[model samples]
Target: MTPIFRRLLLVVFACGLPLMAVRAADPAPPPPAFQEGKEYGKLTTPMPPMVAGKPEVIEFFSYNCPHCHDLEPTAQEWLKRKPNDVQFIRVPVSFNPSWEVTSRAYYVAESLGVLEKMHRPLFEAIHRDKRSLASEDEVAALFVENGVDEAAFRKAYKSFQTETQMRRANQLVQRYGVRGVPMLVVNGQYDVRSPRMFEVVDFLLAR
Candidate 1:
């Protein structure tokens, strides 16, 4: 090759180095047999103590995150189609100020035992209505607008138990290394995103 052609080839080779390394790296292996790992069996995490003997699949979601909002329908569908042994949970991130308010709102709803009613509204309020359900007054107003009694909302919103649950959720975020919202963790054993998600679920389920 000519000297000019040799230099051009060197440039191309340098640019391709990262791609070669990426190809060299081993891809994640296929999903394992179900009932084989703790992530698949007798699911229990210390924080909040989700139901044991029942497998858990978690969607680490954040209200301020548009992607998470988009995943809502898929998550709801999964919840509907989930097996009897699988218990689904949504954990809202609390590491940032913008996300903290939404996390608190989730706890408030859980305390009221009205998750079924408020879950969609909360997401719609922030993502669709452009409302910020931040303060007690705002959350209380949201509750009133959604047919929940205002007084009841306030009572549960600031209750000690509700706050504790919120804190516990924060702990879970750290434990799970949940860097991104809308990430899926199956039975706390594996975190899945994109291509490998459902494949891993099926792999574990077959066992």
Candidate 2:
């Protein structure tokens, strides 16, 4: 090889070595810390805790909401790691008649003791399968197909207990002033707005 060409190759390699070393030594940027009005917001008036002596975290969501469907997996992961002292609750928001139908269906699943089995599938049924759960018959059929007794499903769907839970859910929605689905309210005082919702909730729980 020519002397000039060999020298040039060595010079380039020498320069690249330090550059690569610097890149390898650089630390990753830290995650964003929770901030008021950005990561989360303080409620105008904090609501009373649903579970006494335990911090409460409520997720306001709608079954028909595509965003809520998207967040289900991440939420489930967070639930698995969340503090046992914290009481986590899911409140289905009914912004309209159709959503109210789904909200009632949620309570029916809860009442029939099928929520653990039905939750993810229900989200999939609406969002993944693109099926219609907009009516009582459709909701009942889905539950029955998933191993619930058809008679019991219908009974709970119309029973006073489910109706009471639905009313309470609506009350919490109004009190929280929730206008969007997939919202996380921490300790009834902070409404988490950031995409890194669980991190903010962890911060609030620590505080």
Candidate 3:
């Protein structure tokens, strides 16, 4: 071949090789693994919200539930990193008369502004320490140990506001048709199950 043609051919071959290599190196992004209905189910009748505008992420749990105790750490970690727009709410489930006391403890702690302090300890006291926090008095003692005054806890536990919150929580739980503890409800629409709990939540949020 002529010198000019040979040089042109070499330049074209060098340029073509890089283009081919780039095409081979890049791959398509993998699709999301979470699926609707399988990973999460929608609430048959969407429950009404306690607030407007901000999306709600509710954790329906009970102090007496062993499974809820097991999931506490994961839920806490997720709380630290959850999206700013999301409002994380904890609703204590009252499955029966016995669970009502534990439910009251949640609202009382929230009303007294001690939920952040008492939340984990309440779980630990019940599951880790094997304490029986079944009665109002027993739960108030745990609150006292957590820095809340016994008198204040007693007053807040039976306050009109605390009772209203407790009633609303129970109403929502029934509306959602939640059957178990540690269940996640995303934006009042999706019921997220564990193992892939946060993953499904992240997916629903993206939608």
Candidate number of the best TM-score? 2
Off by over 4 Å in 1: 1-50, 195-203
Among all candidates shown, the one with the greatest lDDT: 2
Please give the TM-score that candidate 2 achieves against the real structure: 0.83
Off by over 4 Å in 2: 1-32
- How does model 2 fare in lDDT? 0.90
Off by over 4 Å in 3: 1-31
lDDT of 1 by residue, 107-178 (tens): 888878888898888888888999976666776788788889888877877789878888888888887776
Candidate order (lDDT): 2, 3, 1
Worst 10 residues of 2 by lDDT: 16-25
lDDT of 2 at 61: 95
Relative to the true structure, candidate 1 reaches a TM of: 0.71
TM-scores for the candidates: 0.71, 0.83, 0.82
Q: For model 3, give the 10-residue run with minimal summed lDDT.
A: 17-26
Q: Write the per-residue lDDT of candidate 2 for residues 1-207, one digit (tens) a residue.
A: 999988877887877753234454678888657778888999999988898778989999999999999888889999999988889999999999989888998898888788998898889999999999999999989988999999999899899998899899988888899999899999889999988888889998988
lDDT of 3 by residue, 34-124 (tens): 7766788877877665588788889999989999998888887888898898998888999987689989998888888878898889889
Error of 1 at 44 (Å): 17
